[model samples]
Target: MTEERPVRWLDEAEMAAWRSYVVATLRLRQRLHRELTDRHDVSLTDYEVLVCLEMQDAYRMRMSELAVLMGSTKSRLSHQVGRLEGAGLVRRGRDPEDKRGVITELTDEGLALLATAAPTHVEGVREHLIDLLSPQEQATIAAAFERVLEHLSEAES
Candidate 1:
C-alpha cells in the first residue's frame, strides 16, 4: 500500500490564472465555431478533420491515426466522419496495406470546402487568440503548452 499525499490546493493567483485560461479557451472555441458555422456551414470539428486529411501527403490517413491526432475516441471520430462522408466531404476506404484498417480520404469536394473555410478559420484564430497576444507572450504560451503537451503525452505512453 502507498501513503496518501495531501492535496496541494491552488492559491488565489493560481486559481485566477486557471480560471482565466479555462474561460478564455472555452469562449474562443465558441466564437470560432460560430464564425465557421455561420459562414461556411461547417463545424469546427469537421474543419479540423478536413485540415488533418489535407495535411497528409496522399490527403488520407487511417481512421485510428486520425482519431489520435484529433484527440478523439474512435467511436466519436467514426460518427463525425460518417457525417462528413454523408456530405460528400470525405470517403471511407479499406487501407491497402491492412485489410482490417479503415482509411479516410478527402474528396475534391472536401478540399474545395476546406479551401473556402481556411480563411475564415485563420481569421477567427487570429482575431480571437493570436492577435490578442504580444510576440513575447505568444512565445511564452507556445513554450508552456509544448512542455505541458509533452509531459501529458509521456504520461499517456
Candidate 2:
C-alpha cells in the first residue's frame, strides 16, 4: 500500500508572504480586467490570447499549441477563440500542415483593438504592480515567480 505524506505547513513569515502575494496578484488581475474591459471592451483572457498570437512568427499559432502556452484546456480555448472570432478580432483556419488541426490568426481589426488596449493595460500594470517595485525588487520577484512556474511545469510533466 502507498503511504500518504504529511503536509508541510508554512511558518508565520512564509504564510504572511504567501497571503500578501496571493492577495496582491488577485487584486492586480481584477484591476487589469476592469481597466481593459472598461476602456477597450476586452477581457484580460482575450487580451492574453491576442498577445500569444501577436508573438507568433506570422501572427498565428495552432490552437493546440496555443492552449499549451496559455495553460488552458482544449474546450476553454475553443470557447475563448470562438468569442474572439465572433467579435471579428481573430479567425480560425484549418492548419495547412494538418487538416485535423486549427490555426488562429489575428485579424486587422484585432490588431487595431490591441493597439488601442496596450497602452491602457501597460499603464494599469505600471500603476498597480510594476512601478511600485524597485528594479532590483522586480528582478527578485520575477526570479522567484519563475522558480514557482518551473516547479509547476515540472509537476505537470
Candidate 3:
C-alpha cells in the first residue's frame, strides 16, 4: 500500500478570509435577488436569462445554448422558459435545422420590461458593489474573478 499523506489545511487568516468571502457573496446575492424580485417581479435568474437572450442575435438563442449560458440544466431551463412564456415575456419555436432542438426568443414585452428595470438594477449594483471600489480595486477584482473562471474551465476540461 502507498503511504498516507497528511491533509493540507488553511492557515487561520486564510480560513477567515475564505469564510468571509463565502458569507458576503451569499448575502449579497440573496439581498440583490430579493430586491429585484420584490421591485420588478423578476428573479435574478429571469433577469440573467433575459439579458443573455437580449445580447444574442435577433434576441433569440437555441434552447441548449441558452442552458449553457445560464449554467443550468435543460429541464430547468425549460421550466424557466415556460414561466417566461406564460408571462408574455418569451416565445419558443422549433429549430428549422434541427427537428429535436428548440429555440427561445425574447418578446417585445420582455424588452420593455428590461428597459424599465435596468436602470434600477444598475443603481443597485452601483450602490452595493461598483461605487464602493476604487478603479484599481475594481480592475483587480475583475482580474481575480477572470482567473478563477479560467481555473474552473481548465478543471472541467
Give candidates' CA RMSD values in order.
0.7, 0.9, 1.9
Kindly indicate the candidate among 2 and 3 with the higher TM-score: 2
- What is the full ranking by lDDT, best candidate first? 1, 2, 3
- After superposition, the stretches of candidate 2 with alpha carbons farther than 4 Å from their true spots are none
Query: Candidate 3 overall Cα lDDT vs. reference?
Result: 0.91
Tens digits of per-residue lDDT for model 1, 1-157: 9999999999999999999999999999999889999999999999999999999988999999999999999999999999999999999999999999999999999999999999999999998889999999999999999999999899989
lDDT of 2 by residue, 42-117 (tens): 9999999999999998899999999999999999999999999999999999999999999999999999999999
Q: What is the C-alpha RMSD, rounded to one decimal, of candidate 1?
A: 0.7
TM-score order, best first, reads 1, 2, 3
What is the TM-score (0 to 1) of candidate 2?
Answer: 0.96
User: Higher-TM-score candidate among 1 and 3?
Assistant: 1
Better of 1 and 2 by TM-score: 1
In candidate 1, which residue ranges exceed 4 Å CA deviation?
A: none
Candidate 3: list runs displaced more than 4 Å. Answer: 1-6
